[model samples]
Target: MHGEQMAEEFPVVGLDTDAREAAELLASQRLPGLIVADENGAPYTVLPASQVVRFLVPSYVQDDPSLARVIDESLADQVADKLAGVSVRALLPKELAELPVVNHDDTVLEIAAIMARLRCPLVAVVKDRKIIGAVSASRLLEVAMTPH
Candidate 1:
């Protein structure tokens, strides 16, 4: 199987997209992550749901997870506020993860390797320098586990 063969249309966000909206999308769709496109519409980076959740947690809690146990439910409900008025770019870590990309004709094994090496849930499949679609980790696993 090839990348395009299994590729599914996936959501793509921009660096300047509202963080709250992005979070809402993730929550509503249960997406593992988003493909963030650059100004030229090429893959810039991935915005994983885990990263957003990490950003929501207060630094103090991250420093000492024990503090999380102390936080009350009321404050927990306001965690989404942290994302208010922020852009996706601001949510990115200081050092970005490698862009998980594959050619349209890349083999399934190739796609799997890129996903495993990057620890990403999605891989953007590009053709002629433009993103056409994406092959998700679950889709790859499905193909791998299924007998031809």
Candidate 2:
């Protein structure tokens, strides 16, 4: 199937949007993920809520007062702090193969192959070499169920 036909309306968050807001939006929308856009409305990074959780939750496992204090903070503050020292670029997958994306006319089989090969939950669908929407793994499965 073509990427345009396979593409579904995907949620987006601006770079200026705080991580907490982004996290909350993800939860509220029940989306598989969100596409982070730049100031010019260009796709920058695709962030999963799982990654947001990872960014917020402390990595250490201890019973120290300092750690406890840190963990007791609000989600917004916690997310802001995490983002203070980080950028969207840092969260991107190291290899392009790991960052699944498809052109507007790409077939469903091609998308499925990329998703499987890259272990991505969704693949961005590009129109005119720009991200317009995404095709989730579930969506791909739905299409595959129908005989061509």
Which segments of model 2 are wrong by more than 4 Å?
Answer: 62-98
lDDT of 1: 0.91
What lDDT score belongs to each candidate, Candidate 1 first? 0.91, 0.72
Steric clash count of candidate 2: 2
lDDT of 1 by residue, 39-135 (tens): 8798998888999999999899999999988899999999999998999999889998777889999998999999999999888999998888888
Off by over 4 Å in 1: none
TM-score (all chains, Cα) for each model: 0.96, 0.71
Q: What is the C-alpha RMSD of each candidate to the true structure, in Å?
A: 0.9, 4.8
Worst 10 residues of 1 by lDDT: 91-100
